[model samples]
Target chain A: MNGTLEISGLSKSYREPVLDHLDLTIDDGVFALLGPNGAGKTTLVSILTTLVLPDSGYARIGGVDVVTSPREARRLFAATGQETTLDDLLTGRENLVMLGRLLGLGRGATRRADALLEQFDLAPAGRRTVATYSGGMRRRLDLAASLLTQPAVLFLDEPTTGLDPVSRNRVWDDIRALAETGTTVFLTTQTLDEAEALADRIAVLRAGRLVADGTAEELIAAVGGQRLVLLDSERNEVRSIDTDGTAASLAHAMSSLHAHEQGLHVALRSPSLDDAFIALTQTHQEVAA
Target chain B: MTALAPDRPSSAHGVGPWRSSGVFIGRSLRHSLRDGEGMLMAVALPVILLLLFTYVFGGAIIADGYVDFVVPGVILTCAGYGAASVAVSVNRDITLGAMRRFRTLPIVSATVLAGHVVASVLRNLVATMIVILVALAIGFRPSATVLEWFGALGLVAMWILAITALFACIGLVSGSVEAANGYGFILLFLPYLSSAFVPIETMPAWLQPIATHQPMGPLVEAIRALLTGAGEAPALVSLAWSCGIIALSMVLITLALPRSKDR
Candidate 1:
């Protein structure tokens, strides 16, 4: 597939099955895995990043088997987990330099660290210990440390969960820049707007299984038509026509109906990505019921 | 874009994995040095204990001479304190997610543990020197030769390793930093209650037997033999006890280490 990630029959469970025979592939772009809380997204990331082992599934990164050659596979990837793993005792610069050294960079590790600090806009606060850093700064430093090796595949688990909108946008810009450099980005997030804004491809996971996977536009199209409404009698009381629940169809229905009423108020109810997501998942829930 | 470009250098002096391990070790040592409270405790506690014993309790306690009686005991006690520090530091690191971060890194798993252990040894050596200087200042003198002094230092270093390993294992099993601290204090306290502080003969008859056979007694007596040219047999007994503790603790720590899933 010429992809960075390939997983098959990836099953992992602690007492009960968390991921049930899950399969997924991520190619050379930013892919967002969207799921509700406790949908095993973190577990999947853990297994994929070699932080946790799956019971029966095999995973490969850049065509290297993660199980037998984890050291080799680890060289090609970096993961920023949901948990804050940065050592509080170390300065932000020290943390980056340590990671660089661990990744086999020698005397030039400090130079790389300085560059990363500057890139992340953390050069001013880089000398202060991480304990004194704000949550957003620590998050940025954690992201910077993970990039010390410049891994081909980067996994960010809920990177912007606690970030303000401005900080989140800044991180998103960094992620985009990384992807533009041919680095494959794998991220899981609960923010629909984030996924909509950044994801080249999106996969919806419910209860550890892939319910839907496609481009955002394709997924939106698959959810069906929109509703169109027109008020014929009064401003408050409106009579509707062609309420199919698709944006394009609703726009056509509204325009066609708008011509017929002289004093009528018309509106188009186009289905949004949020609406499509809720409708699709709710339908799946109903079928399961 | 050019700045972000990978700066692949020539392979003439390519750094290997072992060199990376050395860097990790150096990083850990730097962390220890910067830990203000830890550095204070590692340097100050042993010297305080030595001064308190020699000045406050030196006159009453006698087995040929006070320096002869107290030096061995203080060295062993300092080794015990060193062990406590190792346990506390290791436990704190684990609880703070430092060990977990190290596990996820591309470096060898054993490197982090090795770095901390070596740092602990070096810290203890410094503490030992301070204690010796303080003892000399207080009119205590060693009867042993220069070679014997070095031999004594070497034995105490080995003793620190054994004791530190045991406490490090305890720290691993401990659920929290507080628990590890408490456990380490208790481990160090055991040596004080044994013959390390006072003569076993001076204790109650029932307690005397337990005090003589305890780990600290043999280790302290061995240091005493080396420092004062008392005898070689006691040193052999001390070496045996130290080896036993080291072997047992290593096995326990190996088993106690968390698996990838647990982390």
Candidate 2:
């Protein structure tokens, strides 16, 4: 129940640094590492999951070092990688059963397999080979296989990367449900809304470093309140001005002719994770440079 | 976190010591069985080669007793070739994300390689039996006693196990399933180069020494001797080669398994 993931001063590089001395600690709940492509989200998950080693520092799952004591750390979590690990030749149920047995489930493997199949709404397809299943079904079954042993933590690396919207929501519900049982869920994603919706705490990673870490509200607040924008015909912003959502600020802002232009598109926008990400990382990169 | 000790089984649910191997081996065997085309090819390739050699090339190359002489080579070659397919299977698993999940699990991941090797050996045994039965139908005969028959079977199984392990290592290090297939094909041709098909003496003079020196030559020669009662068993040398290959493959597998996802 005390499941927590902690990584400190962790770094890894192939040609260039993929993860640069990154540090973060996450308690039991839904924690998301949000980043764009090539921001080292997968690399960090690999290191934390013990699939890849770091050049230096340490990563731990439930206080067990993933690098120094990977086998021990492995006990605390099951990872559903970007690629679904389900065997295409095997049935969905068989895939779960195999993992169950491998995790030492014995005869109980079948029971667990059935339970997971039903839980993931895969019982109907459980007998069908994975090769015959839809992409979403395979992703769901992949999640089911990971939960066969019911480890304390679950690591989802881009779990819904190629999923349909409906499937993505189903997986999101599953992650949420697992965390409700006091199981820690560590996830990585590029979708801002996914992190804002699912993660109790979110860490924004940019070029292998933590640019921002906070709740969704905190991140949005950090970016600023709201924006008034004058856009060109292409919807590209021509002039942007920040303003409080209050009518007084809007009235005062509209009073300026410098902000008004003929045939200009006018739009009021609320700050989102995208704005925060850009603002946070833009400043961090500038400072670093 | 770095100071923690190895935890009690996340899998205290494991029934016994053999559970890991049992589960993985079953998984592997089931995979082999389900691949109907692959399974068919495993059995048919050897038999087809046997027929082609015994009828087409056997009479032209030898002045009689050709069927008897070629049967041993075909049986061993079929099994070796079948076992070498482990490289393709193993590489598929690696490329398909099976290994990525395995590494993150609580089980001894090395059992994955064991599973492939064991399954290949078992599957090859079945294919070898069918090949021999076909040989008998085609006037091929072996003069071995019951003890020698068992010895021949065991030798073939050992050779399969060793090559399967070696190919499994090849699978682990290979970047792609196609690449693994290409590498395994290199070893597959060894049977043709060595005495597995024709006697080494029939080869060009310069090529004879190379054929005689390769492991397949000693191994096939040993099995041929046991099957035909043609000469003394030089099986100790074949056994040594099998053990060495298995040992070296095991070490390479361990080294490669952990680093598979790194690249």
lDDT of 2 by residue, B132-155 (tens): 999999997788999999998988
lDDT per residue (tens digit) for residues A7-97 in model 1: 9999888877788899888877999998888888998888877778888878898897777776667777878878777877789999888
lDDT for A242 in candidate 1 is 41
Tens-digit lDDT track for model 2 on A185-274? Answer: 888998887898899898898889998888998988877767888777644548877787789898787787444455677789988788
- What DockQ class does candidate 1 belong to? acceptable
Highest-scoring model, DockQ: 2
* Model 1 per-residue lDDT at A78: 78
Q: Give per-candidate clash totals.
A: 7, 2
At residue B133, candidate 2 shows an lDDT of 94
Model 1 DockQ vs. reference: 0.27
TM-score for each of the candidates: 0.87, 0.91
